[model samples]
Target: MDDLASFLRNRRARVVPAEVGIATDTRRRVEGLRREEVAHLSGVSVDYYVRLEQGRATQPSEQVLDALARVLGLDATEREHLDRLARRPRRRTKPPAGKVRPELQRMLDLVAGAPAMIMNHRTDVLAGNNLAALLFGRPLPELNTARHLFLEEDERGLYADWDTCTLDVVGHLRLSAGKYPDDPRLASLIGELAMGSDRFRRLWARADVCARTHGPKRYRHPLVGRLDLHQETFAVPGESGLELVVLSAAPGTPAEDGLRLLAGFAAG
Candidate 1:
């Protein structure tokens, strides 16, 4: 219920009245469309929408959800996310923390071009090749990607573009929370970040969700200088929510040379 309310509030903040062909006034104090505006646009009573956003009412029906989604300009992903939130919360069982399969580790070993890691839904780095360990730094699990960005002091210098990285990391965490709302570890992680970082709290409040399977990322490695890696994510077959993330540069590129240098340095 709380997640549903938070999602609605976040969506509301991103929409503007005038942009959606509604009247606007400077007298308004809120950042985006008000409750009444959304209510009106969706053809729902203000009291009903208020109760819905406050999480005081029961789960909204499909008709109501469709109306809200349309009024809020939610994309396919966001619309699906909205549906999940609006549904009644289900009790979910947590699986044991998993190990990367032997074959997966072997595959990682064979990938000599770049850093690679196996990550779980909660951003725990289950296993990593030598290059990933050297670049991300340190022991298993402690190097949780989201935690590194929000809680680690040196992380500010590790990524060339800290803001973009944090957005992606937070979005990753937010998406996981929606999928595994009952996971205590994830809840604890979110609580820790909320306590530790005002910036994190603000971003988390936006309630965005993104999964970057393939993308470019900038890093400032201590040994290799600037690196621009094209990252790829693959889901482990027969493994739920396990992703193999590989970061590589094109052949003969400076970034590729940097990875080769770092791999050698990491070996020693």
Candidate 2:
């Protein structure tokens, strides 16, 4: 499970002193908003806010989240992130039918230059080639990526920026759940993660939502020291539970060399 305290600490650290208009006094001990200050700004009791920051509050309402977002000066993206952390419930419905079409798999394979993988709303690795396996570790065809990250021990070592990746994974899941509220598979995945990983539970409760689009990713490959790549997701036309992700690096950088080495490893 992810450490909620750690997540909160990271979020708290990202807000600069200037960003919040809090002049840093010479005697200030804490870097960001004091617990009492945050509580006052959010209109909640200091004790309650402290507990929430400590990851003790099991659930927080939308109003509280909105207040917290306002006080924290969260952007639209960050406010949505806070909501995801506040609103994830415990009970779960069945998961949606999470299967990739054969034609989609063929199409994924046809993207030979860029490493690609097919994933469902639940982040299940449905299909991919040897290159994908090498890049993302062996495909967890039966497991959701969130589960692998939070429940599996290997994930911490696998993802270079685990916290950022966690945000992406959870945000994508939130978006999918919002888009398909009745999707049984997605619901089940959320429930399973919540039950199995306290960190996932904390994040889900915040109610963050994001569409997985294009982004830069840095990976510390087990075999290749470090590589930075760009990830792009393409929606599959007419397919409900599948999307294709492609990873690419700039043509002449060290990242390209690492990717080429990775491809060669896959080829062998």
Candidate 3:
């Protein structure tokens, strides 16, 4: 129907068969749990749930939404987003989301030993510093972080914890979608990813929403081998659509040494 269908489908795929004590079969073909399975767990009619997912059903009551949320095990943010989407009468288009500021580039470059970049809520890598370029490789035609994460083959090798990165990307995009449901580019990006990668499509359906300002990350650097770094994300004052992300390591740590090595080897 709209994002609701996608959300339900995605959330359904994330549930484990045994999670609800359902027996498993290797022949099960659907991504997470089947539509009938979710309906069964939520104690709703399979036909009604199918209509809801197909965008044919009327607005659901609070109890129904709560039941579905509980069945899917949605977190607070995800549950709230679902409520908003369900209440919305129709979809309206908005302009493309915000862009990176010129100052972002200058700020990104000032950092010495860290990999730093600016990205929009849609995970578009608008600009990055030399160290970031060295660490993550250079530009792409699309310059979208999620695209690079899912579409690029080498990305799987670059991140030591690829699966964590995948979930994080999906979660961030889900959060952004919830906040700006009308943004055209965001919708387009979501559709593109859903069409491009099965893994991406499966994750997108799960309705996970997260925005982590700071966290630990692991990367595989050819020069320094495995590097563990902390990522800190800073707001740019005026834009909800853009933020600054910097990756760093504690001083004297091996990851710090890797950052130093990249800086020294890449300076112009």
Candidate 4:
């Protein structure tokens, strides 16, 4: 099955009996909502929903998808994800190689106070400012973050909370992979990581998916020690493959001071 179908199945399995007002009966054969139950809640016919889950149906109407989202109790991100899946044209086309446009590079350079980097859907660091290099410890010229996390030995040392960070990376990648299953680049990256890193293989097998657009991130900088920062990712308009990520620290904090110091060091 494709990623979307598998994801829906997994999510269905996760909503427990108590959460949806279902009884905890040991006699129940299935782990989650029955196909009929989901169809009922989604205002769709059981056969139609089953066809959707089986990857036989495509192009579900927005109203039906919204109903499904409501039935699934999806958050804002999850709802958008479902819509994307429903609206996705039937094609196995690969994503074009993601590149940072000159204007985006200029924008990154212009942001002097905050460290910024442009990353593709595959989490490849296409470009970054000097401050970003300083903060992330001078990322290798052609390194992809997903590859570095799974294959590079130094990744654990760089990310203080290695386990949590690694899981998050893997989960996020899995989500992206699901969204763009036909992308050869993403497939190759996942295949290589699965073969090389047992940890990545295990995580991928779990089928966990996540979308972290904005959040607090803690990093152990080689030069600045532990630094707590907020991270936000902005999609570059008119650019399908590029995303700009900016990191900032709270004002009047040690992290802010460290960031300033690091920026100065980068300049020097």
| TM-score ranking, best first | 1, 4, 3, 2
Cα lDDT of model 4 overall? 0.76
- Between candidates 1 and 3, which one is better according to lDDT? 1
Candidate 3, residue 115: the lDDT equals 86
Q: Which should have the higher lDDT, number 3 or number 4?
A: 3
- For all predicted structures, in order, the TM-scores are 0.91, 0.63, 0.72, 0.84
Q: Per-residue lDDT for 47-158 in model 2, tens only?
A: 9888887888867777887787777666786565455445545443344456777787787777765678888777888887667787767764754678878777444476
Go through the candidates in order and give each one's C-alpha lDDT: 0.82, 0.72, 0.80, 0.76
Q: Per-residue lDDT for 1-268 in model 4, tens only?
A: 1355765776677666576676767788887788788888778899998998898988989899888777677777667667666666764435545666788789889998788898877888889888888876766347687787677744446666677767888877876765786777788888898889889878777656666588777778778877888889888787765678898999998889889989889778
TM-score of 4: 0.84
> Model 1 segments beyond 4 Å from truth?
90-96, 154-156
Per-residue CA lDDT of model 3 for 1-268, tens digit only, reads: 2467777877888888888788878887777788888898888999999998998886888888999999888988778878867877655424344566677678788887888888887888778888888887776214787887788744548888788888999988887776677777788988888888888888765567788578899998877778999999997776656788899999989888888888887864
Q: What's the lDDT of the predicted structure labeled candidate 1?
A: 0.82
Candidate 1 residue pairs in clash (backbone atoms < 3 Å): none
Which residue pairs in model 3 clash with each other?
10-205, 10-206, 11-205, 13-32
TM-score winner among the candidates?
Answer: 1
Best by lDDT: 1
Worst 10 residues of 4 by lDDT: 90-99
Which model is ahead, 1 or 2, in terms of TM-score?
1
Cα lDDT tens digits, model 1, 23-121, are 767787888888999999999999999998888977788899999999999887778777777663654535435787889888987888688889998
